[model samples]
Target: MTEPMRISIVLVDDHPVVRDGLRGMLESAGDLAVVGEASDGPAAVELVARTDPDVVLMDLRMPGGSGVDAITELTRRRIRGHVLVLTTYDTDRDIMAALEAGATGYLLKDARREELFAGVRATARGESVLSPSVATRVVSRVRADTTELSDREGEVLRLVARGRSNREIARTLFVSEATVKTHLTHVYEKLGVGDRAAAVAVAYERRLLGD
Candidate 1:
């Protein structure tokens, strides 16, 4: 029989009750283990270094430091763990910043117990998860950023919005598929989008393409 995947977790929250509750929930899962807890970002980093958990459930606004800062530090140090942000704030800036800082997932504190558990498991497996509400905010922010794109880039984005594959886009633009793919990459970076669906949604929202 295949062994169940073992997950070591660290909880980083300022509230004791929250930490305790999470620990209980996680421990109830046969394969999940709580290795340590931290009341602030600094403590979280220290505990993570010591425990070397597979995942870190990080709170955004802590007393000693910000979760984003912690993520930056951990990523810089090349920590071998996924950071799953668990916070009350779902602002676009916060979501984008966390993702940029190397967080594997973003989930609101109000998530259902099952959803939280699923997020932890998915993050441990290297999947990127974001709350639906947070995703909408991120889409909006990316759309806003598209206004700065050059005309050619806008053309490429419009083709992307129209559901054209890179090859099709290349044919339409009389350019190589590799060039089209490169343009798409630039569009994604400029819009801060990680995927084609997001790029299309942002383009539509910004009136860069007709819906």
Candidate 2:
């Protein structure tokens, strides 16, 4: 039988006890190895660079160095290891900050050992994993953003869905063609789409354009 590939890891948390517990828990799985550890963000960055582990388990609120900043710096330096945030705080601010800073995954400290192990393995493969609550918050935020189109933008999208050209839309809404183009641009941004066809599809998919 072929031996399983060992997934190397670096643990980055300020607390010695937390690191020790994590190391023991992860190493208990035959394919996971704790290759190095750091007590702060700066140290974590250095350790990550030195060890070149497959995954870096990061903590957000260390006294000396912030995990978000460490992830940002790692991104800036183009480090090879994927960062998986393992922190106590799952607030919108904390979760968004770490993800925006290039964390590959986010798992709360209360996660089960199996979940933690799975999160590490997923991160090693460059997959995005989020705790259930965190995922809910992120999805809600995205939905809220996409649903915030202005009344005028909504009118523009509805018309576009009906096969109206920009000129036709401006004429129907008593606006200039330039204004129609501008509204479409804003609609594209809000819907996170590239152009008119994509915007219309996303709008209907989200039920923004009702019958």
Candidate 3:
């Protein structure tokens, strides 16, 4: 028989009941093990260092520090675990900050049991899983910013939107491939999209490029 993938997890929340409930749910999954629990951000960091879980289900608002702070600290220390934020806050600022701070995934507190379990596993596997509502919010914000691109940047973005490769775009624009890459990077930041496909979609949705 193939061995099940073991996921070591750490739970961090201010409420005991919440922590207990999550622990029970995680433990019931044969491959998941709750290695440690923390009631606050500071404790969470200490336990994470000592236990070295593969994934951390971190609560955003905690007593000693915010989940964002914990994520920042952990990343600075070069910890290998992925931080999957499990919080009630769905504000754009909170979501963006957490993502920018290196959180691998985000799930709201009201997520179903299956989603919670799936999210933990996904994070352990280095995949991003955003709650549906959170995903919509993020997509909306990116779409809203698509108009901020410069003309040359927009040209690069339009070609990118049409599934053109960087080399192809460079050839079409009579520019160096390195210059095309530079424009692509600027386009990504301005549009708030992570990659070429996402940037292209955002440009089309926002009418930043002519169809």
Candidate 4:
């Protein structure tokens, strides 16, 4: 019988020690291999493009660009591999942004070795995996908000999530700043959030905005 293919992985973390630790943990599994490594977002993108690994073990707050930025670029390029975020952050904003950027899974750095291993394998199989705490946060938010936003509200929130000011959003959408604020107010109400940051957080968690 032909040998089963080993799962190829690329590690992306700013710390060499962290990368070394993960490499040791992941490569212990006979079916998994660490094919490449990158210390920042730009290098991660370039490495992924060249190696085309089965999964990318990504870090969020790297120097060149964030993990979210890398994921967004990879999605734009239609890369075939999956991105699995492995980091210390599990805040609502962090989780939502990475997931919205097309990450296949999010696992905290503190996860048990077996869990991390399993999450990576699941991600490679096109499954969405979340750390337990992250799963809880997402489930709670998604269950509470069932009201879908109007197209304009979604557009407003998308710009907000991208860090655009109200005036900037108005200019981009060809609307007045007051109109932009009005749309944002409605978006906040619909998503049950009180402010711009919270609205973007919930919108991303609920997938109300296009990636």
Candidate 5:
């Protein structure tokens, strides 16, 4: 029988001790391998592109840089954006930022070793893995909001999620910049978000921007 391939991963965290622990814990799983490690966002981006691992196990709120920024950088560089955030933060802001930045999974640091192992594997397979707590919060928000984004507003927001500026979005949609801003304002009202970042985050939550 052919051997099953191990899921390749890169660990990114500011703390050496945490990275070390993750490396040992993950490698012990027998079906996973840590191919690289980085202590900060910039290093993490370079390492991920060079290594081309199956999954990236990232930590948010690193002092060197944030995992959200790293994820956005990876997406901007057109790297294989399969990032799984493993951090202590379970806040709504943290979760939404990571998701809008292109993370495939979110696992709290409190996850069991086995759960982390499974989360990495699931992330490698292009699955969305959210811890129970994160899942609850996401669900609650989704249920709380039923107002929908209009088709034009949704289109504008989708372009926003792709990192397009107002001018760029306007040009692409053949509309004036003022028109684009108006659509965005309506979107913000409907989504109950203040800015583009928060709007994109909530759009993903409501599944308005489909994968």
Candidate 6:
């Protein structure tokens, strides 16, 4: 039987030792190959263009530019390589930004060698693999519990949760009733609810309205 083709990868991180360690770890898997290494975003983009690897192990906060920017640029340039974020950051902003910029997967640096290897292979296969912590953040953010809701919408939802009528909410917020209705419409749409009570319930459940 023919041997399976190796998955080529490019390592992008500012720290030389981290890169070396990762290269060693990945190469230990018989079907994996580290084809090139870059210490920053610009170099990473260039190296990726040259090597055309199956996957890119990207660090989020690097010099020259961030991994988010690199991923966006690569997407804009239409590079075929999938990017997998391997970094210490698991914040809502960092996770959302990397994913929004087209990263195929997000894994924390604390992942075991086997997990890292599996993540890279999954990423190369167009599968998304998020670390457990990262997955939680993503799920929470998707529930509309985050800053994704505009301030005005949030304020409207808060008043609604307090059992305030549209007119009462408008009076409390100092906005016109028409404006309050518009804001509530937006809130309901964002929260994926059909009415005021449902929107208020979702907001509270998602902790969008602080306890």
- lDDT winner: 2
lDDT by residue (41-131, candidate 4, tens digit) is: 9999999999999999999998877999999999899999899999999888899899999999999999998999899999999899999
- Indicate which candidate wins on TM-score: 6
TM-score, candidate 3, is 0.69
Clashing pairs in 5: none
lDDT of each: 0.88, 0.92, 0.90, 0.90, 0.91, 0.90
Candidate 6 TM-score to native: 0.72
Q: lDDT of model 4 at residue 119?
A: 94
In model 6, what lDDT does residue 144 have? 59
**2 or 5, greater by lDDT:** 2
Off by over 4 Å in 1: 1-3, 149-211
**Candidate 3's residue-wise lDDT over 1-211, tens digit each?**
9898689999999999999999998899888999999988788889999999999999998877888998888888889889999999999989999998989999999999889999999999899999999999989877665448889998988888777898999999999999999998988878777898888887777788875
Which residue pairs in model 3 clash with each other? none
Model 2 regions lying over 4 Å from their true place:
152-211
Write one digit per residue (lDDT tens) for candidate 5, span 1-211.
9888998899999999999999999999899999999999999998998999999999999889889999999878777648999999999889988998999999999999889988898898889999999999877666557677788998999999999999999999999999999999998888777999999997897789997
Off by over 4 Å in 5: 147-211
Candidate 1 per-residue C-alpha lDDT over 122-163 given as tens digits, one digit per residue, 9 for 90 to 100: 999989888989878877776666447778888988877777
Q: How far is candidate 1 from the true structure (C-alpha RMSD, Å)?
A: 10.6
Tens-place lDDT per residue, model 2, 48-86, is 989999999999999989999999999999988799999
Error of 5 at 199 (Å): 19
Worst 10 residues of 2 by lDDT: 140-149
TM-score of 5: 0.68
TM-score pick, better of 3 and 4: 4
Candidate 6 lDDT tens digits, 47-113: 9999999999999998677899899999889888799999999999999999999999999999998
